[model samples]
Target: MIELRDAAYDYGGGGLALRGLDLSLAPGSFHFLTGPSGAGKTTLLKLLYGELRPTGGAALLFGSDTRAMDRDGVSDARRRIGVVHQDCRFLDHLPVHDNVALPLRVAGGDVASRADDVAQLLGWVGLGARMHARPPELSGGERQRAALARALVMDPDVLIADEPTGNVDWDMSQRLLTLLAELNRMGKAVIVATHDLALIRAAKAQVAARVLRLSGGALSAAGADL
Candidate 1:
């Protein structure tokens, strides 16, 4: 659904965060993005979701060049891609269910009519009983699952999770990985950006995935050791 051809991004004077990175994400494909801090994993994710267009090469969303897309075009393209940032950014004042539904509301979706769908999504993420709870009340694992639910609310074709298991313990991380694997089984393209080798290894046992490492402004297939 998305393709990056020799994609490159520069933060003005900061130099290129990413360069000559080529990638293609097809339906039901699974990928793991790994690198050290400041390796441009997040920058690559932004490019995939249309948050930042590539300055040097083409980044395409559903066949349209990101650089050529107008505001509305970019916005429309983003609706097909769901992102879970490292920090689960939820409105503390809103109930868990409300936060999950926020994207739909923002997209002008009829929240009232989609109540059942929203509740079902929460249940899918194992948060059915915590729907009424506030964000601050959730445990780290619960918060991550809630974030996943929120990302899936739009039923996007691709799911991009950045360091999804970073804060959770081993067991929780495994749980989250299983959830992601299950989603892939259901035919959603999944790209998880994490530095945890253990997490990636554990995932390999559960799903077939391409491990890509970003370093020195370039991307390459990870070796078997990964």
Candidate 2:
């Protein structure tokens, strides 16, 4: 869960990208953050994942204030909160399974021992047969699903996805949302930052989801239209 109270982030000469943004994501909760191109949607996602610290007010990840957390504290909190970035980062030279297992390997877990889990996750995302493929070899949907698999490898408490379905086709977008909804059903707080109202509406039809709009440096509850 993430909580922000009057949180403002200023990028020096770039001026303030976000200001006075008040929001909270509770356990088992699902939210859709919608905004225009220049809005601070991605910035808000980074704040939730501890990539950016607020210049003013509070940004809490779990129960600790992010501004007060040391490197170790931030890293520890990240282990409990999984993130799927918009770009869908991956090591081009690594296979899908190894890429998905990177977090565990970094946390010093026995990656080899969890091979079954990794395979299960890949299959869950409909990528079992492609687990051995490199990032460049997969299709767009496969890449997104692979990223999701990587993000969920830690079995995180909170899942933050930034524009996950932005570049994919409609079918792939729905597939990705279904996966996210299933995770929410499994009790992970989910916040997806996207401008895709159609996908948001589709997700709403499948589960209880809240819509929040981030625009003009403020956050407010949006109607179902979002």
Candidate 3:
């Protein structure tokens, strides 16, 4: 549950990235946001996750204005949302499983009690055997899946993936899309921001997902063809 009401964000230096954005995401809903480079797709995701507060209008998460929240409030709000960045920034020195478990560790979770969960998630992402591999040892697809597993380690209510299929091949992109669709079926609200029209179209066939486009600092519904 995230809502933006006529939200406007100025990036300072006399530049406005978002202006008068009105978007709403309900529970269990899946959405795909596509746009050109510098179209503010990532900025929109940051707004939903409490990383960026709106400068002019309302940016609400589960009914609360993000600008009104304190530091702890923002931190707690993030626990309900999982984010997968395009870069898949994993610790180079840590094993894959440990990297996946880092979120829980940072949140002060009793990781020992949930070791099986980490393993299960890795298996779900088709990376069970590579648990002991380091980040440098993983392929691009493997790295993406590992990042997804790490994000889901928190069991977040909402999942925000930014250009998730960017670095993978077509087949691997389809696989990742299927995994995201499955999550939507399991009731995790999903928002995938990507530039790949093919990936978005493929995902639409697997799940009931809305495609939105960001252009000139605004959001609008787009056709499946993109």
**Could you tell which candidate, 1 or 3, scores higher by lDDT?**
1
Put the candidates in lDDT order, highest first.
Answer: 1, 3, 2
**Per-candidate TM-score against the hidden true structure:** 0.97, 0.97, 0.96
**Model 3 over residues 1-226: C-alpha lDDT tens digits?**
8889999888999675788888887878999999898999999999999899998898888888999988888888888888898999999999999999998998999999999999999999999999999999999999999999998999998999999999999999999999999999989999999999989877768999889999999998996455
66-174 per-residue lDDT for model 2 (tens digits): 9999999999999999888888989999999999999999999999999999999999999999999999999988998999999999999999999999879999999
Poorest stretch of ten by lDDT in candidate 3: 217-226
lDDT score, candidate 3: 0.91
- Residue 114 of model 1 has an lDDT of 92
Clashing pairs in 1: none
Candidate 3, RMSD to the unseen true structure = 1.3
lDDT of each: 0.93, 0.90, 0.91
lDDT per residue (tens digit) for residues 130-204 in model 1: 999999999999999999999999999999999999999999999999999999998999999999999999888
Question: Can you tell me which runs of candidate 3 are displaced by over 4 Å?
Answer: none
Candidate with best lDDT: 1
lDDT of 1 at 223: 88
